[model samples]
Target: MRHSVRPRAAALAILLVPAVGIAATPLRIVAEDYPPFLRDTGKGLTGPYADAFRLLMRRQGVEVNYQTLPMKRVFQQVAMQPGTCALAVNYAPGEAETLIYVGKVAPITLTVYVRQTQSEPITNIEQLRSRPVGAINIAEIRDLLGTAGIAFTPVDRPALGIPMLNAGRFDAFISDTRPDVQFIGGRGRPVKAFTLARAERWVACHAAMAPATLAMLRRALREGVFAAETLPVWHSYGMDSFFLETRQQWLQPAN
Candidate 1:
């Protein structure tokens, strides 16, 4: 009877231990509706950045709930809420305190668009100072222009940038996503584009996120677990050139 009691006690101890990798709560992720990067397709979020993020979470066996929120709200919620994260964001000045960056998600190439008819030779960002410029109201873009002391009219979405430019509300439109600029090519007036800035976008969570979860993600990134899975998604979006790397520096553990 003692032998039987000992075996039963061992079984109870095993049962009492929580699952090693299971999360206490699903990770809550949020992103703005930026197409080709992140978008709500009515079925679900389906875009290169979204696909890559899902692959990363799935590999770690972590359950996640993704939501599409306005860009401003996405930044605010990820900054203020624990266990919450943003899908793709740039490292704006001073955000390092509130957010813990997990890994690089995508490459961003900020471009400025102006009507082809415009005779002004605007090769550099500073040249736009003489004319009104419009851009999406996001922190990264704001920081980019603000640092140069350039003021811009803010719109809520990329769709508004081109229209605002055509209506004379803005003289130039600047955006980071290529598809947004290409979207207006056939339907709208002809425009010329110039590269404004380039930077790597990242996945960031609030600093209060579980350390174990954060470590797990960083470990996955260092191990290159999702590289093979996500690189193809980048290729499909015609971004293999942008995403391909001989060495993913982000995959290296911090010094």
Candidate 2:
């Protein structure tokens, strides 16, 4: 009778737990429509960064609801909205006020997109001195270009820089490798990329969330980000030029 009684108690306890697991937490994933990085593929959210984030959260026992919001809306909501997080973001100077940097998703490597027929081949940023280049004012290399005497006109959007370069407005345009590669190639443009600096990008959450939430996230990043299971997450985005080890060494401090 004692053995039968113990078995029945254990079965009853199992029924009390939620199907996702007792420790699982509900989370919301937010991102701007940054392609090849974060975008809606109609199968929920799927991109290189978004896919990796989903896999990380799934391993951490997080049930996620993803939404595509404008950059303004995403910035407004993620800082104070509990259980909400940005999938991929750069570490800007002012963001520390409202968000805590939890994990680095990857490094953003900038490059130059030059039209083959119109521009000379270039190997480095310094070579562009006195050359008219189109770039965003806030790009990481802005200071470098300034000091190097490379002049550029600021474009309102990243994609705009591509066609402006095609129209011969500037010798080259600066943009991240993935997007510039995808955007330029997609349009059947002959623009080629020149490697630039690599900077860290991260996943950040609202500051108002519990400390335990951050701990769980950090632990997930530590255990799951570079694990064997994570490799497929990148390949799922269908990018062959995306190297696996490009930022692989940054995993330790990125957490």
Residues 65-139, candidate 2, lDDT per residue (tens digit)?
A: 788876667767888688788766667668778888887666666667777676467777777776788875443
Q: Which ten residues in a row have the lowest lDDT in candidate 2?
A: 1-10
- Give the Cα-based TM-score of candidate 1 against the true structure: 0.71
In model 1, which regions exceed 4 Å deviation? 1-25, 41-44, 166-169, 179-182, 186-193, 220-226, 231-255
Model 1 lDDT per residue over 1-255, tens place? 000112233223323333347555778989887764576866566565666565566557675678888767887999888889887777765777878888766556677877666766678877888889998776778888888899988876777677777777877888765433234555465365688877777778898888888887776565232365556555545455545441254344442
Q: What lDDT would each prediction earn against the true structure?
A: 0.67, 0.63
Each prediction's total of clashing residue pairs, residues at least 3 apart in sequence or on different chains, is 0, 0
